[model samples]
Target: MNIIETSQLTKYYGKNRGIINVNLKITEGEVFGFIGPNGAGKSTTIRTLLNFIHPTSGIAKIFGMDCTKESESIKKEIGYLPAEINYYDDMTVSDLLEYSSKFYEGDFDARTKELCNIFEVEKNKKIEELSSGNKKKTALVQALLHRPKLLILDEPTNGLDPLMQQKFFEVLKNENKNGTTIFFSSHILSEVQKMCSKVAIIREGKILKIETIDNLRASNYKKVTVEFDSAEMADEYKAEGMTSKKTRGSQAYFLYRGPVEKLVASLYRVKIKNLNIQEPELEEIFMHYYAKEEE
Candidate 1:
């Protein structure tokens, strides 16, 4: 089942573009990654879906319910973590969590306690006294307390330490295993690469690509570096898929996306000293898409 669907969903903030012609269909029990650079409209899309903001045109639905009309009902099944979190500063962590639980109908006390323990959050500390990391942990605890069917996370790991980040991902994985759908939005490509099965890359308020992690990795681009006996030998070499070529004395390095055999044959024409070839990182692959879009 598609737990979330949007078609040509456009949003504009005054004269500035937020997102245009955006479409996504995320299935149940999947961890979908929404990735982009800063100011790429990742937050805009999430806010629109949650009905925190209105769309200019098109449709958005969660569990087949209209986003604007049924948001209250839809929210009952969603656990959301915004990019930035704010709360009453004077309240103790225990008091804040207790207050948050009153909005939901479930008995989340046990789960809340478990989450606080896992995150190492001090219950007695006032919100004003907690560190940024602790505040984030408190926010995460609230979001997961209800055990909602869907999780909408925007830059969720911003204040987390590396160890905490790993632990959080482990928790998310367990939630997915239990059939909770997750929409993970972040600029951190490596984390998305590690956590998501499928990813949507957005830029300048538009989605440029939606691809599986495996297919994205198999996108043919190869990082190739070759060392020659002389700059003269390096200057004479050229082959298909060689782009952004650079030379540093006796070394020539470039990105390739064509047949390896052809690249090898071209190397035979040069007096080679050493050679290295490896897969391009997700960042490089993302830039390739942006380059293609610019073209």
Candidate 2:
């Protein structure tokens, strides 16, 4: 089943566009990546999905329920970690977590304790006294306390140290193993590449591409760097499917997305001093989409 689905999902802020005709289908137990930089409508889409803000047009559904009309019910089975966390400053971490637990059914005390322990949250410390990283740890504990069916995380590793970040992803992997669908939103391509099986790349409020990580990598996009015998040779060399081309003196770098033999045939004509061809990283692939959009 599609754990999350959106159909032509759109949002606007007065006259400004937030997301336009954004569609997504995430099946149960999938670790889906929603990738985009800041101001790329990642947060707006998340807020819309949570019904924290109503969509200007289209529809969003979670677990087959309307996001707007059935948000209360939908939220019950979802855990959310917003990009920015805000809690009652005067309350202790323990107190805040206790208050949050009152909204959900069942005994979550044991779960809360376990999460706090795992995240190293200081229960007695006031929220105001916590550092940014500690605050994030507290939020992590709160979000995972109930062990919801779906996890919606937005820039979840922002303030975490390297050790904590490792721990965080490990925890997420375990959650996915237990059949909890994860919606990981971030601008960090490496993080998405590490955790997600499939990813949707968004820019300027539109989804540019959606594909499995393996398929994306296997899309025949190659990062080719060629060093010619002279600057003139570097400048004159060109081939089909070459894009985002740049040349400096005797070196030329470009992304090629065509048959390797064709690229080899093209290169055979040039006085190539050295050549390097490798699969483009997710970041590079992401930039290729942005470049296309801009063009």
Candidate 3:
């Protein structure tokens, strides 16, 4: 089932384009990644879906219900963790959590306790007193406490330390195992690469591509670094897929995406001190997409 779907979903802020003719379909029980740098319409798209803002022209649906018209009913099944959170400053963590729980139907005490324990959130601390990391932790706990069917997270790990980030991911994995569909949005490629099965790349208010993580990783790009005994030898070797080239002294660095045998055969002529060939990271692969668009 498609948990979420959008068709020609466009949003505008006066003359500024937020998202133009954007389309997306996310299946139930899948971890979907929405990735782009800041000011790339990721947040705008999300906000429109949540009915926090209206789309200028287009249709968005959650569970097959119109987003704008059925948002009140839709929100009951969603747990959202915005990129920035602002709880009542004077309230303790526990108090804020308890207040949030009242809107939902079931008891959240046990789940809240479990989440707090996992995140090590200090429930006694006032919202104003907690550090950024701790505030993030609180927000995460609140989102998961409802045990909602879908989780919409925007830059969810912004302030977490490494250990806490790991713990949070583990929690997400567990939730996915239990059939919670997650919509994870962030510019951090590594984290998305680690957790999501499929990802959609968006830039400049447009979605460039959507593919499974494995397919994306296997999509032809290779990171190659070559070192030469002489600068002349390094300069002589070239291939069709070679791009983003860089030269420093006697070493050359670039990306290659064609047959490895052809590259090796070409490299045989060069007097090289060392050679390294490996798959490029998601960030590099992402840049390749943008580069293609610019051309």
State each model's CA lDDT, in order. Answer: 0.90, 0.91, 0.91
State the lDDT at 18 in candidate 1: 98
Q: Give, for candidate 3, the lowest lDDT window spanning 10 residues.
A: 278-287
Location of the lowest summed lDDT over 10 successive residues in candidate 2: 279-288
On a 0 to 100 scale, what is the lDDT of residue 26 in model 3?
94
Hey, what RMSD does candidate 2 come out at?
4.4
Superposed by TM-score, candidate 3 places the C-alpha of residue 32 at a distance from the truth, in angstroms, of: 0.4
Tens digits of lDDT, candidate 1, 194-253:
899999999889999999988876675788999999997777678877887999988999
Distance from true location, Cα of 185 in model 2, Å = 0.4
Q: What residue runs in model 2 are displaced by over 4 Å at the alpha carbon?
A: 220-284, 290-295
Model 3: per-residue Cα lDDT over 1-295, one tens digit each: 8999999999999999999988999999999999988898999999999999999999999989999999988989899999998989989999999998888999989999999999999999999999989999999998999998999999999999999999999999999999999999999876888899999988889999988988776665788999989887777667878888888888999988878998888888767789999766656666788777789
**Per-model TM values vs. the true structure:** 0.85, 0.82, 0.87
